[model samples]
Target: MNGADVIDIARDAVYTLLIVSGPTMAIGLGVGLLIALFQALTQIQEMTLTFVPKIIAIFLALVLFMPMMGAQMGDLMARLMDRVATGG
Candidate 1:
Protein backbone atom coordinates (compact mmCIF):
# COMPACT_ATOMS: atom_id res chain seq x y z
CA MET A 1 0.00 0.00 0.00
CA ASN A 2 1.08 3.54 -0.77
CA GLY A 3 0.75 6.61 1.45
CA ALA A 4 -2.85 7.35 0.56
CA ASP A 5 -3.99 3.80 1.13
CA VAL A 6 -2.20 3.68 4.44
CA ILE A 7 -3.81 6.96 5.48
CA ASP A 8 -7.25 5.74 4.44
CA ILE A 9 -6.87 2.52 6.44
CA ALA A 10 -5.64 4.42 9.48
CA ARG A 11 -8.53 6.86 9.22
CA ASP A 12 -11.05 4.07 8.92
CA ALA A 13 -9.57 2.31 11.94
CA VAL A 14 -9.74 5.45 14.07
CA TYR A 15 -13.28 6.20 12.94
CA THR A 16 -14.40 2.71 13.78
CA LEU A 17 -12.69 2.89 17.15
CA LEU A 18 -14.45 6.13 18.01
CA ILE A 19 -17.80 4.82 16.83
CA VAL A 20 -17.43 1.67 18.93
CA SER A 21 -16.26 3.50 22.04
CA GLY A 22 -18.31 6.68 21.92
CA PRO A 23 -21.50 5.47 23.54
CA THR A 24 -19.90 3.70 26.48
CA MET A 25 -17.58 6.63 27.06
CA ALA A 26 -20.47 9.03 27.00
CA ILE A 27 -22.38 6.95 29.49
CA GLY A 28 -19.40 6.82 31.80
CA LEU A 29 -18.92 10.57 31.50
CA GLY A 30 -22.55 11.19 32.34
CA VAL A 31 -22.46 8.92 35.37
CA GLY A 32 -19.22 10.46 36.60
CA LEU A 33 -20.63 13.93 36.26
CA LEU A 34 -23.75 13.05 38.13
CA ILE A 35 -21.75 11.44 40.88
CA ALA A 36 -19.50 14.44 41.08
CA LEU A 37 -22.49 16.69 41.42
CA PHE A 38 -23.92 14.54 44.16
CA GLN A 39 -20.65 14.56 46.00
CA ALA A 40 -20.45 18.29 45.66
CA LEU A 41 -23.92 18.74 47.07
CA THR A 42 -23.56 16.31 49.92
CA GLN A 43 -19.89 16.93 50.72
CA ILE A 44 -19.45 13.16 50.80
CA GLN A 45 -15.92 12.81 49.61
CA GLU A 46 -15.84 9.06 49.27
CA MET A 47 -13.37 8.01 46.62
CA THR A 48 -15.04 4.71 45.86
CA LEU A 49 -18.43 6.22 45.31
CA THR A 50 -17.65 7.30 41.76
CA PHE A 51 -16.02 4.06 40.67
CA VAL A 52 -18.96 1.70 41.28
CA PRO A 53 -21.62 3.67 39.44
CA LYS A 54 -19.37 4.54 36.51
CA ILE A 55 -18.24 0.96 36.14
CA ILE A 56 -21.79 -0.34 36.33
CA ALA A 57 -23.07 2.21 33.85
CA ILE A 58 -20.25 1.48 31.42
CA PHE A 59 -20.76 -2.24 31.77
CA LEU A 60 -24.47 -1.95 31.11
CA ALA A 61 -23.76 0.28 28.17
CA LEU A 62 -21.36 -2.29 26.74
CA VAL A 63 -23.96 -5.02 27.14
CA LEU A 64 -26.61 -2.86 25.48
CA PHE A 65 -24.34 -1.76 22.63
CA MET A 66 -22.51 -5.02 22.10
CA PRO A 67 -24.27 -5.90 18.86
CA MET A 68 -23.62 -2.57 17.26
CA MET A 69 -20.05 -2.60 18.44
CA GLY A 70 -19.57 -6.05 17.00
CA ALA A 71 -21.03 -5.01 13.69
CA GLN A 72 -18.73 -2.03 13.45
CA MET A 73 -15.69 -4.10 14.38
CA GLY A 74 -16.64 -6.78 11.88
CA ASP A 75 -17.03 -4.25 9.15
CA LEU A 76 -13.64 -2.77 9.96
CA MET A 77 -12.04 -6.18 9.95
CA ALA A 78 -13.65 -7.03 6.63
CA ARG A 79 -12.37 -3.83 5.12
CA LEU A 80 -8.84 -4.48 6.40
CA MET A 81 -8.90 -8.04 5.16
CA ASP A 82 -10.13 -6.91 1.78
CA ARG A 83 -7.25 -4.48 1.59
CA VAL A 84 -4.81 -7.19 2.52
CA ALA A 85 -6.28 -9.60 0.00
CA THR A 86 -5.92 -7.05 -2.73
CA GLY A 87 -2.21 -6.69 -1.87
CA GLY A 88 -2.66 -3.27 -0.36
Candidate 2:
Protein backbone atom coordinates (compact mmCIF):
# COMPACT_ATOMS: atom_id res chain seq x y z
CA MET A 1 0.00 0.00 0.00
CA ASN A 2 1.01 3.61 -0.49
CA GLY A 3 1.73 6.02 2.40
CA ALA A 4 -1.81 7.33 2.50
CA ASP A 5 -3.28 3.85 2.52
CA VAL A 6 -0.92 2.79 5.28
CA ILE A 7 -1.93 5.83 7.31
CA ASP A 8 -5.57 5.09 6.83
CA ILE A 9 -5.13 1.50 8.00
CA ALA A 10 -3.18 2.65 11.02
CA ARG A 11 -5.83 5.20 11.88
CA ASP A 12 -8.55 2.60 11.59
CA ALA A 13 -6.63 0.20 13.79
CA VAL A 14 -6.16 2.85 16.46
CA TYR A 15 -9.77 3.90 16.32
CA THR A 16 -10.95 0.33 16.67
CA LEU A 17 -8.62 -0.20 19.60
CA LEU A 18 -9.97 2.84 21.36
CA ILE A 19 -13.54 1.86 20.72
CA VAL A 20 -13.01 -1.66 22.04
CA SER A 21 -11.20 -0.58 25.19
CA GLY A 22 -13.12 2.62 25.95
CA PRO A 23 -15.73 1.16 28.29
CA THR A 24 -13.32 -0.75 30.45
CA MET A 25 -10.98 2.21 30.65
CA ALA A 26 -13.80 4.53 31.63
CA ILE A 27 -14.99 2.18 34.33
CA GLY A 28 -11.50 1.87 35.74
CA LEU A 29 -11.06 5.63 35.71
CA GLY A 30 -14.37 6.25 37.41
CA VAL A 31 -13.75 3.66 40.11
CA GLY A 32 -10.28 4.96 40.74
CA LEU A 33 -11.51 8.52 41.05
CA LEU A 34 -14.23 7.56 43.49
CA ILE A 35 -11.79 5.53 45.55
CA ALA A 36 -9.40 8.43 45.61
CA LEU A 37 -12.08 10.76 46.78
CA PHE A 38 -13.11 8.35 49.51
CA GLN A 39 -9.53 8.00 50.66
CA ALA A 40 -9.12 11.72 50.68
CA LEU A 41 -12.18 12.26 52.77
CA THR A 42 -11.38 9.53 55.27
CA GLN A 43 -7.61 9.96 55.35
CA ILE A 44 -7.12 6.24 54.76
CA GLN A 45 -3.93 5.80 52.79
CA GLU A 46 -4.33 2.24 51.62
CA MET A 47 -2.62 1.51 48.36
CA THR A 48 -4.44 -1.74 47.70
CA LEU A 49 -7.82 -0.24 48.31
CA THR A 50 -8.04 1.08 44.77
CA PHE A 51 -6.88 -2.08 43.11
CA VAL A 52 -9.70 -4.51 43.95
CA PRO A 53 -12.61 -2.24 43.15
CA LYS A 54 -11.06 -0.94 39.96
CA ILE A 55 -10.23 -4.45 38.86
CA ILE A 56 -13.72 -5.66 39.59
CA ALA A 57 -15.33 -2.75 37.83
CA ILE A 58 -13.10 -3.13 34.82
CA PHE A 59 -13.73 -6.85 34.66
CA LEU A 60 -17.48 -6.32 34.85
CA ALA A 61 -17.27 -3.67 32.18
CA LEU A 62 -15.30 -5.99 29.92
CA VAL A 63 -17.83 -8.73 30.42
CA LEU A 64 -20.75 -6.40 29.80
CA PHE A 65 -19.19 -4.84 26.72
CA MET A 66 -17.69 -8.00 25.29
CA PRO A 67 -20.17 -8.31 22.46
CA MET A 68 -19.74 -4.73 21.33
CA MET A 69 -15.98 -5.06 21.58
CA GLY A 70 -16.07 -8.20 19.49
CA ALA A 71 -18.23 -6.51 16.87
CA GLN A 72 -15.82 -3.58 16.66
CA MET A 73 -12.82 -5.88 16.33
CA GLY A 74 -14.60 -7.96 13.72
CA ASP A 75 -15.41 -4.86 11.71
CA LEU A 76 -11.82 -3.71 11.84
CA MET A 77 -10.58 -7.08 10.69
CA ALA A 78 -13.13 -7.16 7.91
CA ARG A 79 -12.04 -3.78 6.66
CA LEU A 80 -8.40 -4.80 6.80
CA MET A 81 -9.06 -8.06 4.97
CA ASP A 82 -11.14 -6.28 2.38
CA ARG A 83 -8.31 -3.86 1.76
CA VAL A 84 -5.87 -6.72 1.38
CA ALA A 85 -8.19 -8.65 -0.89
CA THR A 86 -8.60 -5.63 -3.14
CA GLY A 87 -4.80 -5.38 -3.37
CA GLY A 88 -4.64 -2.05 -1.66
- What is the model-wide C-alpha lDDT for candidate 2? 0.94
> Each model's C-alpha lDDT?
0.96, 0.94
Q: Write the per-residue lDDT of candidate 1 for residues 1-88, one digit (tens) a residue.
A: 6899989999999999999999999999999999999999999999999998998899999999999999999999999999899897
Candidate 2 positional error at 53, Å: 0.4
Question: Can you give the TM-score per candidate against the true fold?
Answer: 0.95, 0.97
lDDT of 2 by residue, 1-88 (tens): 7999999999999999999988899889999999999999999999999999998898899889999999999999999999999998
The weakest ten consecutive residues by lDDT in model 2 span 18-27
User: Best by lDDT, which number?
Assistant: 1
The RMSD of every model to the true structure, in order and in angstroms, is: 0.8, 0.6
Candidate 2 clash pair list: none
